[model samples]
Target: MPLVRIKSLPFDHEVPVPQVISALSQAISDAANIEQQHIMVTWEYLAQSHYSHHGQVAANQPINTHPLLIDLIAPNFNTEKQIASMLELIAHTIAEQVPIAKNNIFINFTPAYSDGVYDEGHIVEWDM
Candidate 1:
């Protein structure tokens, strides 16, 4: 099981949630070599007024300095090179979908033991 959670300032009207989700899932699946069916992507938008950076509210700013957080939980751990490649893919995909600096994107990968991740009441396990 792999869960991808994207957290950022409230999306503007132009930001298409479905497309963003699809792109993220596809990018992650391809980069991580994971099955698309096992990947889950979700997002939560925070009001700019409630999200602050350097003690300043980002509500009225044209470009938010606040970082976009991408949390990924997967059953398998990856090499540092693999993770780096995945992060690059994620940053590019997100930037293409929304207006955010690539440097402001932060992706955290958490590796889950098979026993800890489940789907449809069945625990996740490596096929090979």
Candidate 2:
């Protein structure tokens, strides 16, 4: 299972949450080499002013410096190439719906215990 969090500067306008969720799930599944049904993704939009770059507020600028920040947690058995592929897919997927540049996207992945994650007192299993 994979849990993903995406944080980005607010869009010029609103975006449908369902679309974002679907796009992310598909991209993450491709990147992480996992079944799409097992991936979970959530996102938030932050004002540029809420973040900083080199001690300067990004919101004061006309352009965004750090447009996207992604946090992902998943099993640790993926190969290096698989991880890289996932990041690339994530960036491309977000860019297809947002105006952020791929270079400005930042993603961090955490290795998680396969059976440690639980919801409602039941352990999450990779049954598929």
Candidate 3:
């Protein structure tokens, strides 16, 4: 299953969680063709003060975002590139609503293998 998770490091800003989720999921579903029911988008809140590490400006830093990273496991790994491309729409939608920089939103995709993956409680070949 492909899960979309959003973690925030806001800097002295108060954003509506419902707005973010609504915009993000709509954009993701439209771009990725994943039904709204199947698209699992979740987010966690973090204060600007909490984003600091060793006392640095890393928290809620918009300049450090990467707008491309996607992981789609086989037998659908081929969709990885397309999925990565769709992130921009998601980022842009969020940016329009909030102050999140398009560039600072980084996404990563990983294709998992036989490393503990099973089909219906058993190892079997599946095709759709």
Candidate 4:
């Protein structure tokens, strides 16, 4: 399972949040070659006043200055190339679905050992 947490200011009113989440989840599922149901994508909206850039509050700066931060946590089974490809795909998908500039999107990947994750009432164990 892959868990994605997207943090950013609220999106423009033109795009529905649910649509963006669905697109992101689908893109991750496809890039990771995992089942769609295994991917979880969530967005955490940061109030403009709560975010900062270069010591300047987001509310005081241009919206473009605010960055889209993404945290991807998944099993540590993927190769380096696979991880890179997955991040690229997710970034592209976000750019397409949202108004954020591609450069302003940042993704941090954190790999979790299978046994470290608990799901469905038990620890996760990957079948080799």
Q: Which candidate is the best by TM-score?
A: 4
- On a 0 to 1 TM-score scale, where does candidate 1 land against the true structure? 0.84
Clashing pairs in 2: none
**Among all windows of ten consecutive residues in candidate 4, which has the lowest summed lDDT?**
56-65
Higher-scoring candidate on lDDT, 3 or 4: 4
lDDT value for model 4:
0.80
* Cα TM-score per model: 0.84, 0.79, 0.64, 0.90
lDDT of 2 by residue, 1-128 (tens): 77888986666566676797798898776655678877889887776589876676665322347657898777777667766777778778877776666777889988776687785468865542
- How close to the true structure is residue 92 of candidate 2, measured as C-alpha lDDT? 81
lDDT for each of the candidates?
0.77, 0.73, 0.57, 0.80
The pairs that clash in candidate 1 are none
Query: What is the C-alpha local distance difference test score of candidate 2?
Result: 0.73
Instruction: Please write out the lDDT profile of model 1 over residues 2-93, one tens digit for every residue.
Output: 78899888755467888899988988877777889888999888776887777877763234478888887765656678767776887889
Top lDDT model: 4
Question: Model 3, residue 24: displacement in angstroms?
Answer: 1.4
* RMSD after CA superposition, every candidate: 2.2, 3.1, 4.6, 1.9
TM-score for predicted model 3 compared with the true structure: 0.64
lDDT of 3 by residue, 29-50 (tens): 7776766775556777565545
Ranking by TM-score: 4, 1, 2, 3
Candidate 3 global lDDT? 0.57
